[model samples]
Target: MERPRRPSFSELPLRKGDPPYSAWGLYGADDELGTMNLITPAVTRAAVAEVKLGVTIPLDLPLDAIAKPFIPSRVPYEHKLLARGYANDDEIRINTQSTSQWDSLRHFPYQSGYLYYNGVTNADISGAEANDKNGIQNIARKGVATRGVLVDWCRYAKRKGIEVSPFERREITIAEIEEIAEECGLEFREGDLFILRTGLVEKYRELSHEEKCAVAERTGAEAAYIGVECNEVSARWFWTRSFAAVATDTLSFEAWPRKNSEGWTWLLHEVFLAGWGMPIGELWDLERVAEKCEEVGRWSFLVTSQPLIIEGGVASPPNAMAVL
Candidate 1:
């Protein structure tokens, strides 16, 4: 079968701007779907070969599971029944990013007056007009399914007898991810959904109420989100590898309480989300997926996700599933 055609990786550095990122022109100036363009019909059809076991693993955490907000900016969701005893519907209010969410392009801005993915302005995010500009809905209806790969850093840490802490900012470099891939005998492909498990979610689950409160209080304005390295090395590694999206078992995809150095602070979220139009996901529960991969001697599967079709929304929980 002929492979789906798209712009080559060498075609990147698409924009000549300061951050050196853009796919805006590749799809179109009006394009809301960014790297998602990599997942063509051909890719979707070919992805099925990854499903050999017919087992589906849910990747989303319970909406209300984070009794204590791991991220101070995020607010917990409130649920209310619609009618009375005979009511069959319920209304719920959520912050979209409260749990296991995907950060859309509008989730961040390059600057107050600057543009976002595909040159979308602050007005686009606010729905100044009725157009769907870089919204989560732009990608949802198309279905975000692809070959999903797991990098189980927790298992690797335990095997190496490295003590991993959840309440501290730890940088997982590109070298580490590549090393894990080599050890697992897995190959990364274009448009792959990379799920990185640092075991932060697992560690959080084990924390006592007081411990959780203490951690939250101690890190009042600073959340030591354990995450992937946000340096240029990691940025180049990710872009060059052609992974369409990334989700992590931490609060932020990139290490938080991040020091503003070497432009790393701005580059991670800036380059990935707004600059490159790549989606960032966090708070994914990958415990079972890791266990399954370990048992079956496989770390690659067909992953699928569909965010809520909300217009001009900043973020949404990943309605994600991995099938083996």
Candidate 2:
């Protein structure tokens, strides 16, 4: 039987700058015809065989850089204690921004309309409790089950004898990612998670405040450990191929001090979260994973990521593992 023609990006009545509703449409007709849900229920039961690769944010980690300033110290001791104790659990703060996290749909809003997922009206996303119930917090709890491909951009750069300083402006293109994958003899598969390691976090931690500021100024973007790029073609490829998620060892999925409209506008976030409803995992610990992959000379592994189940929370620290 002849397959029906796949629709073109322009054919889909999506908002401008919005990522295509079906990434498969970018490849060929029939790409979008496949019946496969990227986020499946099976992921929840997937055995966890790998070590957790998320960073434990220092209790004193500055929240200003990533989020609004935390003012607990300014609050009255009794109220502060009450809030920080999570209603008596002094060990757990009720709202400390300094924690491993993910941004929920409510993190950003478009001037037009639309929350993380398309067709989900803002009215449908109101209220912290309501948003948390249906936001990234819940989606993350389902866990991400798939193979994970680690592309060590730092190692690749080192081999090339090009000292790409994490402190310096670094922007990895999709072509570079593809080349690195090819060099590593890795082949991407459907329902895979691509984790790009750029050695940003290590460098960022070592840099002096002045150095960090200098790097940020030079890049015109905040100092980040890693970021993502698709260059139209790659973006199209990712969408059509059914990747479950894309994460990085950086602060964001894109380069620090982003120069394009995408970051400030949160276009990629919208595309992945709202248009495609895919989750983005950032601030992962990739050094160990990269070293392991290099030692084994293998690039692919089974990846397991399960986020905390906090109803109405926007993001959660991913309990991620990579099993070879």
Candidate 3:
């Protein structure tokens, strides 16, 4: 399948009275795949060509890496081994979003209108009947195979002598992201998977057990962390770049406790996951990949991910891999 031309950022909301910059009917009223639709056969083929060294890196953190749930309401993973006469079976229960995950279209919605992508409402997600609209299964069925670009913000920060903490609500501007990509000699392409390494996971590894617990205890406005700015400009940049998906080592892809500056009040979660029907991958394990990119002196690679295929599931762990 060849890629189709999408309307520019300026040509959004496609429908009047919808949220700002929403691509609601771009794919069609009943469209479920969202930006994953951008990953056509040609895009996948181009992505496969990025595999030069045949290095495959796993992008998911261990399921139990975060023993405590950053969101207190979420349950920590539990495991049970069932013993049979000659074999053993294991059963594990997990809060999918507790670890590394992809926030599906059903995960969030436009705050003002309380509607998900294509006007899906809370009732649509939690109604009595079983509805699979905008489920992660759609993404799982399609699978995400595309060219990935690793924007190593940590490396860029070090070289620029900028001091910032991943544990804080520091916002990475779009200009900075463009600069990082330019510095790495990379150009944005439609259907590309934009993977950002903010060193949040690396810093988490340095925290003491007690400190980790304390960090996890933070909730609501207190659970502040570093990530991309969640504003119109940033949203425009992302849409124009035409990234099929985006992942980051931080807890959320956008800055926590979103800052409402310059009249920009909504979170990127609202804009991307809800408005544009884009996926947001968080808590990805990018340490080794970042190092490998630095050593190889190349930033683009082939990336593929298979999301859990739960029919009405909201989110899931991305069984993702990067090939270079």
lDDT of 3 by residue, 1-324 (tens): 433568988888888988877899878889988898888899999999999999999999999998687888899999899999699999999999999999999998998878999989888889786478999999999888899999999889889998888988989988899899888899889899999999889889899989988999987777899999888888888998898989999988888877787987888898899888999999999998999999989999999899999997899999999999
Ordered from best to worst lDDT, the candidate numbers read 3, 1, 2
User: Model 2, stretches more than 4 Å misplaced?
Assistant: 1-36, 39-90, 94-99, 104-114, 127-133, 208-226, 261-266
Ranking by TM-score: 3, 1, 2
Instruction: List, residue by residue over 28-89, the lDDT tens digit for candidate 2.
Output: 32221121244344432342332243322121122233222112222211223345454554
The 10-residue segment of model 2 with minimum total lDDT is 68-77
Give a tens-digit lDDT track for model 1, residues 65-99.
Answer: 77767666656678987776765788888888878
lDDT of model 2 at residue 141? 46
User: What TM-score does candidate 2 get on C-alpha atoms?
Assistant: 0.68
Q: Quick one: best TM-score, which candidate?
A: 3
Model 2 residue 318 distance off true place after TM-score fit, in angstroms: 0.3
RMSD (Cα, Å) for all candidates, in order, is 2.7, 7.5, 1.4
CA lDDT of each prediction against the hidden true structure: 0.80, 0.55, 0.90
Residue 120 of model 3 has an lDDT of 92
lDDT of model 1 at position 200: 88
